[model samples]
Target: MGFTAMGLAQNSISGVIKNENNEVLSNVEVLVSDAAIQTKSNENGLFELKNLPIGKITLIFKKENFEIKSEEIAIGKQEQKIMVVVLEEEAHHIDEILVSSIFNKTQNENVVKIDHINLKNIQNEGAINLSDAIATNPGVNVVSTGVSIGKPVIRGLSGNRVLTYTQGIRLENQQFGEEHGLGLNANGQESVEIIKGPASLLYGSDAMGGVLFFNPEKYAANNQTEFSVNQVVNSNTQGSNSSVTLKTSEDKFKFLVQNNYTTHADYQTPNGETVVNTRFIEKDFKVGTSYATSRYVADFRYNYNDLNLGLPEEDIEDARFRTPLYPSQKIENHLLSFNQKVFFKNSKLEATAGYVFNNRKELEAADEVALFMKLKTFNYNVRYYLPDFGKFETIIGFQGMNQENRNFGEERLIPNAKISDIGFFGTSQYKMEKSLLQFGVRYDFRIVNIHEFGEIGTEGSFQKLDKNFESINASVGFKTEITEKITSRINIATGFRAPNLSELSSNGVHEGSNRYEIGNPNLKNEQNFQVDLNVDYNAEHFDFFANGFYNSINNYIFIAPNGNTIDDNFVYDYLQNNAALFGGETGIHLHLHEIDWLHMTSSYEMVIGKLDNKMNLPLIPANQWKNNFRANFNVSKNIKNSFVFLQANYTFNQNNVSEFETKTGNYLLLSSGIGTDIELKKSNFNVYLTATNLLNKEYIAHLSRLKADGIYNMGRNIVLGVNFKL
Candidate 1:
């Protein structure tokens, strides 16, 4: 792929590392971010990466107990001489490279502000699942059917408007249904990155709300084999989660396998009454492999998920672990993806493909299946990153997907349909001394073909239909430093989403909602324009950030009653109108420079949505205020990285609501945990104990779908977990 790869020349780079005392450092990890090339320093503090492309590239050096170093270097036609670098002891956790960013820039350097968090940090905060972990971030919430089933709501938007990506591919699992969950497990993932605003210019259609990207765990170090296991126990629900991962890596090849199992009984409230039929079980298995050279890289991953979930109605029972009763759901999901990258002397090209299979079944009785369907999707993406033009960088890409849905049960929620999507986009970034500018344009076309269902003119029948939708979207952003420690960023973006089948072809009795639903085949696409602003101040021991956004949407889709009834069910119609939402988040972090062992953090976030007629939108999250205080201490040289924290979360009363919604009062909850690590010969062991809803608060959340039934969220639950590796 490169000149050196073609045998026309040989290009190489070497480096040496040392400590402040001028002593040699061994086992230091040296990496080239863009090229996917890495090597470890030998006993002599020397590392070399050969067959590199001839151009400017970034190098990263990392090791435990030392500050990370990022260096920019240029490689010429010939072999490079050794470069020397010095490392200092780490004072605190600092910035790390963002994997989901198109340019691989850190948070401080990117024009668009992104939120990133590690899974370990989330676990320590008393999060028992993926949904709970994501909701800990600012400006993000979840719409929960129960403790086991939660859907992410980003900036007041849920359903198909938000996109989920894992292993560099989209995740599709009938997410348009209100009762559908995220269909993801947190077993093998390393961290998560969230784009809080519109991302349609980078992703295709369904990204009007935002993007959730999960980064998988890394393989073992070169020429090493590792095995890791984790076990978690939850008190209130009597749940247990267990996982094991094994990995082996050679110089250029790596392989990994992971297995996870989770099971929970009904969750209990403060009064000790369990929410009946809230139990669930999940079995997840994942495999991954990769091969890389200086000029090329290839990776593959596959995951299979099986879930058995029970649906709660007007019932209460004692907590117990058992198989789900009637009115339960069984979901099976499969995902496989492969990607490869080629690096030339001055440019790079990447191609990726993925396939997903989803089978969902709703059982009404032991022998009766009320609904069953299968959805298959195929996705592809190709991109070319042009060499730098002075200080400008550019990328052109094509993305598309083909999907189909089929029903196998007697009842069909929507007609069998085929969906296709195609989009082309180009984005660019320009760098200046103290500022960066980014802008992009994207064009997308989507087609939905619905087949006939049942009888044509009957009450329980649907008609055949075909629709096409297309839109052009664009985004622009700028980041600049106003002072040595103060920075500001502004981004404006336009996004769009094609109507899903449920909105375009529904003509049936929806039992879950107790309404006779009707669909409008003439519905248009939902489009929106949003503007975001962020400011940050970083001092020696204190840092503050404020983020705000305003979003306006045209042709917003919703359902409403029309003063009619079918078999005691209210008749509702699908409708559209203009709507707007605005919100912001502000937070501060104080490191307590005088006392290196202590640090504090706090934040406030809120969002409000209203239609053009001034009617409030449904399912909006109430205002929230969160605070945490943490302290770290050292045990012994062999047993380090110990920490403890206490946190308080308060939700303000939500009086503003739609006509059909009820108001929710304010509530506060406490959480805390402590963990430490012990090192052994080629092994490590860490343990932690955490508690959520520490005070056993009995209050319902404003955004919970179960709020109408007066069901409270999970109460005081304690968790114990351990991680061991060898």
Candidate 2:
């Protein structure tokens, strides 16, 4: 839930490293993965760790031209130990240890398949925002309104269907609207793990679509201090992003702080047209601290974000406005999280409580706040890890949230409401020789209370009401290592989501959507069941994977035009129906054995959604094929870890569309980049240059709201970045 390093070492451990032939292996790397502790073997092939916590920890050893090795060990409260370690002279990939997904189990050992991407991989692609960064992954897409505002779409489900968690808490912004953006920044971010199917079995409701869990940067090494600075410049929008971070950790305490600032002008299209009122500015700040002993651990984290985003609904005659123009959105968010753990002799308890406040405003003119809303959410989770039994691991948890939404200003879209949710779940895993079985069951109860607003019987009016929803869900999964080089997995899960305020009681024209919408008060819950299958083949020089899923949903809610107009706005009605969606992703990675430094990757992804009546679902991404070829090598003694890459992504034409949507033509996007790491003694620096939309193809994306206005996405942008560390 918090940072991974939970150290409580009270004793000392020493070890000696050697090769198979019993020769001392100097310069070997030894690490405690979860504790964020590492040391290099001296010339004598000896390493020592002082004051380790009294628990089971994974010790990993690595060296050049050698296979990675790991051992699980338990430390006593008061003990001194010495050990010997031996390595084999071969090279192989090591599975990543997951922290939040399923405790400390590696990816291969888990029954549920997940997708992960390092934040650096996203940055190296020159992504300007988190939404764009994650969209590069398979089975993921984004619905964009402009260059500055985009929402993540997973497996053709978006809006209130999917759930997002940051800092181990649910991120609640005004995301019920499709025009809203993910209120997140990458100031102190690390990597992200994605559960591609129904995750309600773990994270409760609204995760029927899936879950996006973001992990923050790990704490600094014990007894060490670190500082870094990063800056990037963009050519298309004349944008600039800068950030600074400082972190320090001691034997029993840790602290970290970071800040980020970003600004941009209007983005230019491939046709050399500047989209008016597309500028934005952002400021972000973060702080974190932790304390731990052998049996107790506590962590606290805080973040603040402020943003001003322009909305390009019309042209602005004035060209001198430096900040956002009229019809813009200003958002401010604050997050505070506290985590604690209590360890017994054979079991442990982990609990995290978080508070989030979001302030959102839409301005229509000079100093005019047409629509303003404030949302406050308090969420808590507690999980108890039972002592590991032979071939069995079990966990029981309880999760709940209390959310309040209030409105101000002239526009009233939804009524003021208070929503509460509580859920209890238990899950366990059974390990076998070559196969693993995992299952879980969850019970959820939710209540929504709406307060009346505006005049009775008029638009933007609501009556006082209260409603309750409950559900019981479960999941079963199995993973089998069919052969030495092959693995297969299958999972079946059920998920459900109660109707949101916007889908239940809204009766007005939403901001920026150019439509009059009406909600159905009697809408039922959306329940879904999905089956997922995955097969992977890993060999010496190649890796291949194929994934497929079929999902069936009941009481799916959709909005469509009813051939009528209210106040010159198209009248749309929210409707419900049974629906189905099926999709798959396949990819292959090849490392050139002869070339040694060259690698190639290719992948394709597709999804199709349909109602019971055979009508296509709206906003589904088109079929895609992506390819990348890269080379890595040491440039010189001073410049090391240098690389170059060429990439191409092709989006196939989308003739399949809903009645209210338009078809889009096919297009190809080309991009390339170069970068390197520089090490001058104790100081380090990194610099890179990347270009996107190399061919400047001016095509409208199928999922972009700007397509209705005949606007093209950003094109031919160059980004230059630099980093310095001390």
Candidate 3:
């Protein structure tokens, strides 16, 4: 019988659920008694079972496609209420070990999903941004000003089609500005989640490509204050960076503050020649605060950053590219957000509000008045959900956003643009014995108002315009477990994206890409329909997953070569074009051995996309794959509290190339690292050294946005880093 019949005292069992690798797992089904009382975990891997009788109970922890676990738990009348649980990957048979990489995964009969890249992977790479770490994934590539400014490009989609976020808040960078970087840093972050294929059911608009969510560490435990620091030095460019973080939490309050600074010189090629070397300086600061009571919780965060990075510039008179564009890539950004939650009985309500401000300045490649731009955005959202409504749960939400874009340049005085959108979203989920069904829908109403400023030379017309857009997108998905160890999932989703400023008013040289891009005023929003499927299998010692997806776009806005035009100058216009898309990705993870004190993990991913029945799509990579091997060893006699890890990754060459551009040849890059941990009096110290492009391969990636003559990825770089935790 359920709890009410038992004359039990009020108490709780609270704790975080983790895997052997110390990574959190969400939605793990925990059954507390033989009567089948169950509870699920939150995003942070936190869970609570309240109002339980103070007596002996049998606890059962089971998840779809995972081995069932049964344990005897005694609930003493005056015992502690919190206990941490760690689950181990089970093996299918003798001599066949299950693989459980640090990657997070969920499985059903038809679908297996993996979304998180943990700190273990992040520590093995020496990079400036989240994109650098993400690029290690098989189906993922980057389109950056150079290696240092990478942004994820899934399949054939990049730019406005992809969406990025920090924690649960939307990223505020001027993403529509193709020259801008994704800007999120990996320092002090716990992990990053990549939602591939069509995820429009949760995120709106740009889900056509995919979404990257960076999650920071949660609050510390037991009101204890903890500090962490990372210092890194790179050999390729003689660069260095450092990050510091402080976190603490009490029963009622929690917070984290982090700061990072980085400086790098121009990078080199395998031959050690400075290739269009540029210097960059960056600083980032973030603070997050949270408070919670029995029925109420609140969270707030503030992020700030300042960056000055150089770009390539071309000289009109000499037909030669210039070094270190006078303006450089200077950007200042600030973001603030607040979230509140109220709980009653079996339902909860959440409200979120945020503001983002960004400012950027860069010198024009040909014209004078330095190009400067500013963006201000304000957004709010409200959602409510109720659990225990029979076998189904329902969620409803509303969101609103307002943004203003301002541009200042010498050639043409483009007026500021105001953009606004309002949306409603809802999702419902039902669970059967071995299957789950989910349906979600979103409706958006968007408007844009533009004003013209100054005179438009005989080159083009200058006018004011107003536009409105209304659209509805929906998604349906199913996940089921065929047996206790195999699961599958399938989904169909639709998405829409509104035009941004860069696509509607730009008319100058884009220093970042070394291209003179002109905007089209008559462009239309793009829409997408997509379907995805996946499979996951978990054995005693091996875990693996495979996923496939196809996406098609209506009114796809692609840049096309439209001859040349003569104003006071002659320039080629890249106009918009319609197109269709299809692609998929698959990966598998394996765990080698534990008894021998050895652990091995490996994975590979493949992605493909074609447009208009053609094999070529701009800036999309074909056939990307990565193989990672890591070994952990402990040193007990020589050093106290010491361990070492050796890791390596190999990225295969891409075969996909654009028809409009020269065919890109494939290249192989290799990276490796080693780290050791030591315990000191009151703190812990960890040090590591990483070498990238270990073989000194000198080739360009097909998806790189580097200019044909300028901007080269760094070659043969070494990084030494140390971390102190207390």
> Is 1 or 3 the stronger prediction by lDDT?
1
Worst 10 residues of 2 by lDDT: 1-10
lDDT of 2 by residue, 401-440 (tens): 9999999978877779999999999999999999999998
Give RMSD (Å) of candidate 2 vs. truth.
3.4
Candidate lDDT (C-alpha), each: 0.86, 0.85, 0.65
Please give the RMSD of candidate 1 to the true structure. 3.0
Tens-digit lDDT string for candidate 1 (1-726): 012222334666666789989898987988766644567898899877766555566778887768778776666565554678898865554566776777877787789888998887788777767887999998889988877788888989988988999888999999988768888898888888999888998788889999998987777666678899999999998999999999987767889999999998888988887788888999999999988765678889999999998888764343445677667899999999998888777888989899999999999877899889999999999999899999999999999999999999778887899999999999999999999999999999998999987777665577889999999999999999999999999999999999999899888787566678898899999999999999999876788999999999999998888899888888888899999999999999888768867888899999999999999998889999999988877899668778899999999999989877899999999999889888896689988899999989999999887888888889999999999988
Clash tally, candidates in order: 0, 4, 23
Cα deviation in Å at residue 693, candidate 1?
A: 0.6
TM-score for all models, in order of appearance: 0.95, 0.95, 0.83
Candidate 1 TM-score over all chains jointly: 0.95
